[model samples]
Target: MYDEMSQLKNLLELIEEPSDINLDPEEKKAAQVERLFNMLFEEHEEHAKIVADQLNKSVEEIRSLPYSEFRKVANDLGVADSLLFKIPRLNRPRTFMSPKDKISSKLFEGVLPPGTNKAEIAMENKKSTKELSAFVSVDFDMLPNIHSSQEITAYDREVHDAIVSLYVDGENEYITNQMVYRTMTGDPTAKLTDKNRTEIDNSIRKCSMTRISIESSPQEAAVYGMQTMKYEGNLLYTKVVTGVQSGHINEWIYIMEQPILYRYATSKGQLSRTDINLLNTPVNKNAETLMLQGYLLRRIEAMKHPKYNKSYNILYDTIFKHLKIEAATSGALRKKHSKLRDTIKKILDDWIEKGFIVGYKNNSDKGKSKSLSIIIK
Candidate 1:
């Protein structure tokens, strides 16, 4: 039931690293469990008694159970199976990209400068400067296209999507420009040329500079095990290192998933994985499609039904929020809302044609009940 004491200590050390490593509440609990077991293995009867009480068994019975059986007993006591089996060593395939539910739902919805009116004014002024110089000096021609804080767009979210593959925890992660290129382009065979490499670098810089703040309800905070309901931080922090002698460059990107966001990632149920290749394709590249898809991806996963038989009921106002639609008057808002309904129909029709979904029904009644009922395939 116990491994070598030295091995157990090493595992605890790895989990409790003093760096900027962010462990969700469950991980901290897992660490506590390891500490308890280590004490029990050393014949600590009090710790054994605690587990025995929880499981309604004798201290000897609790100690006699194998580690696997102990996990099952703890699972029966409401410990998550993922924490017991998958967290210490995640075994996810490389094909799927796991973006946090909060990020997916809010990141593209006018949060990161795109879809906001301020972005339009900034684009017209065109005062973009070179911000990547802090990371690494490059040729004038090699600079990213939009370097200013206000120039973030839907395209930048693509970079965020790609980089999320590196965001397992709060610790800084290393990646090369080539890996970003492959992930963003969704083709492992895609070449890393000068133009696209500059684009990737620019996007990274843009993401690092953009700030985001999320305010969650008490219910939401409790659901994700967050101690607080409010969070404010930048989405990313990036440092680039160039090997002058080897002419190679690598990026150390720190994904700052705050307590709420980190809990969303660790909860497993609060995250959604999209096929990288299909998501980056030209068909889903537009802002509306991207925003709607992001919202749908997160919402669809929460549906309590099997696939091909499930449907989603989305409100017109909900679509307006996700798509960031704004209007000056009720009449104009209604017009734009009507137009957006058509736009959504066309987008859903395209999805149906591509066989991504089966069909949808419009339940708009020209009243407060305007909504869309979409059938999932």
Candidate 2:
């Protein structure tokens, strides 16, 4: 009798409740719009993803689309123009030109034109390493048109690093080139040779072509055999201005824009001093090496997960997802997940050997059937 009464009471309550959640289609749609509207106003990046979902598009593809598309979508949805304005412009990766400091980027991605060498691109990456603080995209599109030998990459980076240090230190740019090399990017153990001087000169010549050449005086112009240029393009011109004193020279403009500036592929991420130093350290000049180091370090530092700790059991799939997101941010030519995984494993192994990571282990060796894991000091 007690069980029968319990069942009878449950059946009465079941009849009291609504069986169909979407019985009111209008209410169901209203609820979804309400939820989406709340998300759009409350979160920036989330709003982008939500909008992308409503349009039946991937977040990456939607973010990369033209702003005009957003406007058109707004029209279709009967939403206010301010709706698009409120979301963070993920499409901002496109370049912009500032008269004070020039910048531009073409949205199109394609194979390089004939006569374009990819190695020349490696040169831009090396030079921009120090200048780019938050972001650096390694692709053919953003590099300067001027081609350079593979060897000059290190020297190009060094010169730019020194120029930035001088500006930040409140020191005059009139310092000798040799002093800049030794103090900034030179090796103390090895003596600077004639070859080093020639290399430095060559690097400077290549960098100068990125902008309009600047000449301080007629005498200095004659010394270097400066040529008058009239052709104009989107690239910024470098002009030498007199330092208001005899024998003083500053090669770059100093008025509004800071020296060692980069156009895009950089953001003010305000990375830790340790992260920045590791990325800029001269131990490895390869862009891939540095990017990998920096990217992994950032993940290891900032990740908050059930598995994250001094001894985190990071599974391969977890790493795959993280790396895919990171690769998206980098805008690499293609998604090389397998190669990237192998490269990262090798890098971590190397770091463990070098004492950069402590208490490291190979899951394969341990045979810890629980999936791969690593521990760090």
Candidate 3:
């Protein structure tokens, strides 16, 4: 039973690490049974004992039952197997990119400095100067024109027909006129209507199906071709713009899932993963950096609002306040303070090139030290 409990915990960890499990039908069935065992024997041990006691069975007997027999027992105990299976296992949130592999890949792609680590690359990418430099330095090779100018083949006609058919099939009376008008006059408000919006959304979804195929073809071709052209074609831009617009439609979803406010309140710090995700998303990275800077500045302002005297005193008071809210009787406040300080230091160092904050040497009556301050300008 103890061994089963340990295996169950290990399975939960695996599920949490790779949240989206893709398994064969037989494997999925086995995974479901494993999930049930984990939920009952590992996560809800005390509850499992209570259920076993009510059923006049020993915990060991319950653990030793076959999957089919366990299902029967669960049903008799009025426990929903489906509900238990659906419960998400808590896991450490993964960073947006793997530190080693992703950083090395970016360096080879010429998007990062040759010798930089993942943490350093992440920090550099957040800098405005580094971004501008990359934008200017990186050269995008163009795709070759494969078709001959004089020869008109059946394949050529078929490709053109396919592209045109895709466009025609996607059209709607509602947005077509507005889209035409917008094309003519360069005014987006010409297409501002519920019917037009719905039509545009439908068109975009249909277009996306083709775009994915086209994008995948280039990647497949790269395996064979020595000098692959990383083309910024019309299709690619259209897909990118559509994706950005779709993100706007789902803005509320992202905002609700944002870890900034929650992490600030609960952990008393921001994680690097949070910042990296924010930057990687289609939303404006510069604006996000400024927003983060503003949040930190606000915290500092609150601390020095003429009510709190010494900086250390402010820190102590803030820690105590959070401790009260958390009902933390242990040394949790001290642990949280350490995390907060580390988070602040990381942010200050990374966002320095954005001109949102600055770090300076602090040499007072004591030895030399370093301190961070908000760039007020």
Candidate 4:
């Protein structure tokens, strides 16, 4: 059997850090080309075919062009050029363009000049002023095997996702407080309301302490790139978000630095190797974010015990309250029993449509009625 840890590490380093200082210029150039090709392979699958058709060159021949040689051709070709410049600099999240090879070194190695912080140094040194990218590559393989049942309120998940969106965007360092408030509460343009700010503070504190278990062996999971990212493992590295206007509300945001692995985020933003966003998006009649969350929580509860597995049917009311829905919204949202029941039933219908759950035996009210069951693939 192959050793996954060492192989994945080597594969990432060779492909990720192509411009490593240790490599000679020729070797560095070759590595850079390979990494660029890999990025193209992931994002722009048709690049090879496009170039091949235009130049009347075989895909293999076009691929054979080294970094230096391809630059000239890419400039002339434009977006379909598939060159380093054609892709957004944001795409080159991991590869630091600073004088220092790594983003960490750039921030940490030098003595700070007077008034600057890490976020300030990052803005001056990094590729983008608005977004901060993760230093480590995003690993997707072991993410699916994580079995976590600890329920969290939808608000916390949103807060987590907003921060995670930053992480996935490669803003793994100091995220702006405004970014969090905007992304989490779904009021992107406006400043954080005092009520929302308190919600943020509470959620972050909870996120720091919460830990989901890895059902598999720790060593095995780590070797497979799960990164030992238990919430309780290392507290989120939070700092005052720098780079804000003096009049604006400034607060802290967090990221897990190097050596600490990031766990899978619950948000739909986390993409897999094939570019699939695995998070389940439930449809709500209201179409609002909060309403959509209610559907999601209901669906999750439904998964825990389908009537097919056990004798008892999972009650809509049981799931409704389990989701921690506030009483105020419940009265307004759940006014008509049939209406709310139909809406919740639509969740089961959608699951069945997606083949996530099954209607193995729906004998109607008089006959043998069973809950909609989960279909385990």
Candidate 5:
């Protein structure tokens, strides 16, 4: 197993080249990248399974094994030794740190715009002071700070209190290093501030009407529709619709929607419709109202089951099937029509090229039809 793991890792490394060192370079690159990613994913899953299987053993017995012996066992089972090393790193960081600081820092970093002071922005966001302090302490620990951990703790508390006071007094819009220093010095106006009230007001106004488009990708549309179903509180039924526009070739979209029904029951728990139309909308569309309607029909068909009791569900299922079947038939007709149109266009172009079809005759309809007598062949 160890040998197999090493072989697989070596294979992955060999294929990591940007340019293919094998046949059909472009095709090779595409295949190799896909293969590599899939291989890594499968390897991780296999390693997890091995670790889970080990959980059945007694903890003391497991711990009694030396690192070398454990590595050999894992190797025999095809688990990569590097993966075992990574497990400690992955699990230890959180156990040694407080959740408040680490979790809040991560969340704050994600939400705040670039160039914002992390510690100050974190505090302004009402994050726990002790957590932020611990987080900052860890960060400062990596640096060559002369201050002792005890001194750092005291400084963090003082700064936290001062920042909270200014926040309450409306003197500071957010916490910052400078603000902390000013508060410590007992000077209110000593820090440089960029709490631009105008900017804040403008941001609020701008965000209120902000429209977020999902970029109309098929996967994104499907996920969005599923999310909408989850939002409507129905976890069971999630459906996705995908197809091309009948009349518009090379155009495709998906739609995701939810169907929900609730009724008052005599019992404390409400008697709800057995069939939840949790997903009842088109997940993707090309802005065509008619096409969107067709997409919705497909989703409805996917959700239909006899167990569903809601009258609306039954009606929706019936209508949706009718619409979907009609759209499919119409799509066939449109494809034939488009093919005929293309044929006519090609015939006209060929005639024109051969001098068999000329430009229209004189301005009046009385004039003879455009000449097409010349024979090029």
Candidate 6:
């Protein structure tokens, strides 16, 4: 019942208004309301009937109820306030952006080797560890004319961050490429250049084209309180529209976020927050640095207590994998690994100096494999 109501709530909130006709405010609203009921009856007949029965009314009667009346009755039906509407949480900082924790923890990586467009990364679920094939595989198929790597890059992450910010629980967004650019640049007045527009366009297409497949064992399903669970879809559903009116060109991008992510975001312990300024931070403006900071932010946000150690250890190999760094030879790999350690330490030091963290430490593990783990504090 809750799920059914939730879907209806989303429908009421996100229904589009008629744009072609010129009508008075009341007439426009009346047209929209009529269309909404028609859609509910046609597409969601079963759920609409269920809701109607809950209100002691027939489906037709419920459909004919005034929009305001239906909303009032729905609210009176004991759905939690937060589930029905957006309510500010006390613990979250106003300036922070909350993304699904899995993505923040490296579901999508920086870059893949050229000529390869698929990534089969390990899913970060404890129950699935015993299963040999538990993974979240992503494949990006780009349109012909895009020159960059087809895999999800830091630039793609920027576009993703911007698009995810627009999602309220699970609502789709209608936006322009310029809007995406502005969101990333953190400037309302930022104008999209040809380069910026092209990047945004490519990123949007790649994200939509990217297919995600999650595989888990029966044990994993039981742990998640389900008999069977599977997810396979694009990260986002994107519709690109280009129209020429009176010799003027207009382009609109419509993005529908994946439903499972919304379910996770609204569920406990599955969402994480990061400083909204990270994307536009002047300290290290490069995409690689932004990606590193994003990965670190997830660790920071996972602190169990305020006074708990604000540091954690990550295997060098894991870091390399998350950053999608590769070397052709063993000697070259050692050199790149050493260089990466120093670079990461420098980046964390800069973060501390900029007051992003109170203090920082880079403690190399003292073990037989001494350089295996980098302790970031």
Model 2 clash pairs are: 212-237, 212-238, 214-239, 214-240
Instruction: Give per-residue CA lDDT, model 6, range 164-238, as digits (tens).
Output: 655542233556776666555544556677767767766776777676665555655666777665567776786
TM-score-based ranking, best first? 6, 1, 4, 2, 3, 5
Query: Candidate 3: what lDDT?
Result: 0.32
Q: Among these predicted structures, which one has the highest TM-score?
A: 6
- lDDT value for model 2: 0.36
Model 5 ranges off by over 4 Å: 14-109, 113-377
lDDT of 2 by residue, 1-377 (tens): 12445433322222111222324534643443333334333434565566778889876675444545644544444443323221121111111111111111111111112222221121123334332211112222323343344222323544543444433332443333454444332222324456555455444545444332111233322333543211222122222221111212212222123442332212212222221222223343233443344445544543333444344565555544433334454346235544555566676766566555564443543642223455655
Q: Least accurate stretch of 10 residues (summed lDDT) in model 3? A: 247-256
TM-score of 4: 0.35
Q: Report how far off residue 372 is in candidate 1 (Å).
A: 11
Residues 1-377, candidate 4: write the lDDT tens digits. 12455333332333224124356545655555566555544543476577678888876676567545455444434432323111111211221111112222221222222121112222223343443222222111222122222223445445554565555654555455455654433333546555556566555555444432212234423534764433223224443321111212223353545212234222112221111111232433122343443334334433443332433244445444444345366566556433545555565566567654454332245642323333433
- Candidate closest to the true structure, highest lDDT: 6
TM-score of 3: 0.21
* Candidate 3 per-residue lDDT over residues 1-377, each given as its tens digit: 23545543433343211221245435644554455466557755776688789888887798778656666666655553322322122122112111122222232223432111222222232333432111111121222122121222122211221222222332221122233223211223333455443333333322222211111133333433623322221221221100011111110000111111122222312212222222221121121222333234334434434544444222324323322324274577557544445554555555454443344222223631234333332
Q: How high a TM-score does candidate 5 get?
A: 0.15
Error of 1 at 198 (Å): 3.4
The Cα RMSD of model 1 versus the native structure comes to 19.7
lDDT of the candidates, in the order given = 0.50, 0.36, 0.32, 0.39, 0.29, 0.53
Single out the weakest 10-residue window by summed lDDT for candidate 2: 90-99
Off by over 4 Å in 2: 1-155, 184-190, 212-257, 260-377
Ranking by lDDT: 6, 1, 4, 2, 3, 5
What's the lDDT for residue 180 in model 4? 62
Encode model 5's per-residue lDDT on 85-157: one tens digit a residue. Answer: 1111111010000112222223212332222123222222244233211111112222112212211222222
All candidates: CA RMSD (Å): 19.7, 29.2, 24.9, 20.9, 29.5, 14.0
